[model samples]
Target: MEHANDITLTVNGTRVSRRVPARQHLVDFLRDELGLTGSHIGCEHGVCGACTVRVNGEIVRGCLMLAVQADGCTVDTIEGLSDAKELEALQKAFHERNALQCGFCTPGMLMAALDLTKKNTKVTREEIRAHISGNYCRCTGYQAIVDAIEEVVNGQG
Candidate 1:
């Protein structure tokens, strides 16, 4: 058996530590080990962005990263969207716009959207689509998602 390594990292503003197998995928470590199931596992090969999470302000597929690699990094998941009415603008906008369905890809999509918004406050529709190309929404066809992001980044929310 592979002996697990002790790992500690900050997640969603909380410090978390665990003994994980060397081969444990960061997705598993986050979801199963740490109970941060916001990072979903889809097409584990890194193609699908369903497992996306922000590490040090950059979107990274949890499935493609090792738990150990996040030793000293700060990670953010969909659960970090906001508290109460903090990100309410974006959350309410997304809900009203119907940006999600099935919700399997919601977390990753949000993380990517956050990245795009951070890249530039004036992000356009086409730009948002291109930014979230890695995240696939099997249900909604992406129109509402784009609208939600546009509304938020453009400060219409």
Candidate 2:
């Protein structure tokens, strides 16, 4: 039998409490329980950044974190960031640069990019590439994605 634990966490600035399976991944909880599907489950391992989410101001792989581990933590997903207009500039840049094609990795890519932006005001193209290296985009070849992030870093976006 699967064990369940009661967890309370702040998601997208909203307080949420739920009883989830002990082994339930954070991404599964967000997508299945909360109906927040912006973060996609890619590799299921932490290797792919498709399930990235901000936990207590740091980006983490949702797949690697269990739902029970997020109790009392502040979790931010792509929907929340977009709703708060925190990702407006990056989103605009991504669109203008055509950085996203399949869009399967867009949410995670944006989250990683946003994290890098918060860390530094100025970044080189290679730096931007290295920062987002964890996120895999099989469609765009990453050039457009890098361009978009560079534009945002330079304050052009």
Candidate 3:
């Protein structure tokens, strides 16, 4: 039998309570339990940013954090961001620039870009690259992705 821990948290502006397995990571809980599949599981080591999400308003790797650790915190996934219309410019820019090829890393890249742009939308291309360095995109080679993010940041989107 798997050990479970009861926890409560706010997810995408909704209050949620569940008995999660003690070993369950936040990504697993979000994907398996809450059915939020936008946050893809990549390396499972926090090295890749595929599972990036906002916990308590800070971007964090879902794979590195346990579910119970977020008991009283607010979790925001790509679904939430999309629903909030927070990623509209980035989405459009990504599409126009062909930043997403496989679409596997788009969510995480968007999440990371959200964090960066939230700080300063007028960021340089090198700054954008530095901010998104953690997110690994195997397809785009990053130039298109950088162009997309730069456009959005530079207010062209």
Candidate 4:
């Protein structure tokens, strides 16, 4: 029998409580339970960074974290960040730079970019690349994405 655990967590500024499977991934729980689909499931592993989300103010691989592990923690998805206007500049920069193609990786890319930008205001291109190395974008060849993030870091965006 599948075990279910009751969890209460804050998501996107809203308090939510639910009973989820013990093994359910945080991203799956967010998408299936709360209808927050901005974070896509890619690779189903931590390496792709496609399931990136903010947990307790830090970026984490949602797919690698169980929903029960997030109990009482604050979770922020792309939808929440966008709704809060926290990703406005990055979104605008990404759009203007044509940083995304298929868009499958945009949400995770944005999350990673936001984390890096928050930690460092003045960043080099190499540093930017290194920061986002975990996120894999099948399209765009990463050149435009790097440019967009660099622009945001340099205050040009």
Candidate 5:
């Protein structure tokens, strides 16, 4: 067995320190070590965005990143997007518009949506589609998800 060592970093606004195996996936570190399961695991090969998380304020697939690589990085999962008091506007829009079907991909979808907003809130339909291309939803036929993103892109939410 490979021996692991301790590391410290900030996660979702909280200070955390722990020892993890060098080969451990960030997804496992977040979900198993830190107990933040919002970052789901679908296609572990990185084809699916289900394990997407923000690393140092940028979106990265957790399944594709090593925990040791994040030793000093700040990580934010879907759980970190909003406080318990209220939901993020995109979340509300998604919920109101029924953006999720099975919800296996909603976390990644939301992460991508948040990033898209940083570029510009007024995104074209095709742009929205392209932004979430990394994420795959098994349900909803995409119309509602697109509509929800449009609501946010159009600033209706």
Candidate 6:
């Protein structure tokens, strides 16, 4: 039998309650239970930022956090940001700069970039790289991603 508990939380501004397995991580909970698939599972060890999401205003590795830990928190995934039109310019910048390929890491990269941009709109390419160093993208060589983020930071995106 699986060990599970019932919990309620706000996701993307919608309140929800569900039974989650004790061992189930937040990334799986979001993708499997809530059907929010934008957060990708990579590395599973938190070294990779593939499953990054904002929990109560801070970015966290979904793979490292348990669903129970998020019970009373407000979770924001890429879907929520997309639907909220919060990442429109950044998304457009990525598209225009061809910043994404294969797209496995795009969601996490976007989430990380979103956090970075929020902190300081005036950012340098090096700073951008440092901020997103946790995320790994096998394609695009990161130049495009950096350029895209820079464009957004400069209000040109």
Per-residue CA lDDT of model 1 for 1-157, tens digit only, reads 7977888899888898888898998888888877878789999999989999878878899999999889989988777765423356667778999999798898788778877766665977888889999998999999999999999899775
TM-score of 1: 0.91
Stretches of candidate 4 exceeding 4 Å from the true structure: none
Stretches > 4 Å off in candidate 5? 84-87
For residue 12, what is the lDDT in candidate 6? 98
Which model, 4 or 6, shows the larger TM-score? 4
**Per-candidate TM vs. native?**
0.91, 0.97, 0.96, 0.97, 0.93, 0.96
Error of 1 at 32 (Å): 0.8
Tens-digit lDDT track for model 4 on 1-157? 9999999999999999999999999999999999999999999979899999999999999999999999999999999999999999999999999999999999999999999888766998899999999999999999999999988878865
**Alpha-carbon lDDT, every model:** 0.84, 0.95, 0.94, 0.94, 0.86, 0.93
What's the CA error at residue 119 for candidate 6, in Å?
A: 1.7
Selected candidate, larger lDDT, 1 vs 3:
3
**Candidate 6, overall lDDT?**
0.93
RMSD of 4: 0.9
Model 4 / residue 17 / CA error / Å: 0.6
Worst 10 residues of 2 by lDDT: 148-157
| Backbone Cα, N, C clashes tallied per candidate | 0, 0, 0, 0, 0, 0
Error of 1 at 36 (Å): 1.3
Error of 6 at 11 (Å): 0.6
What TM-score should be assigned to candidate 4?
Answer: 0.97
Report the lDDT tens digits of candidate 2 across residue range 18-119.
Answer: 999999999999999999999999999888899999999999999999999999999999999999999999999999999999899999999999998897
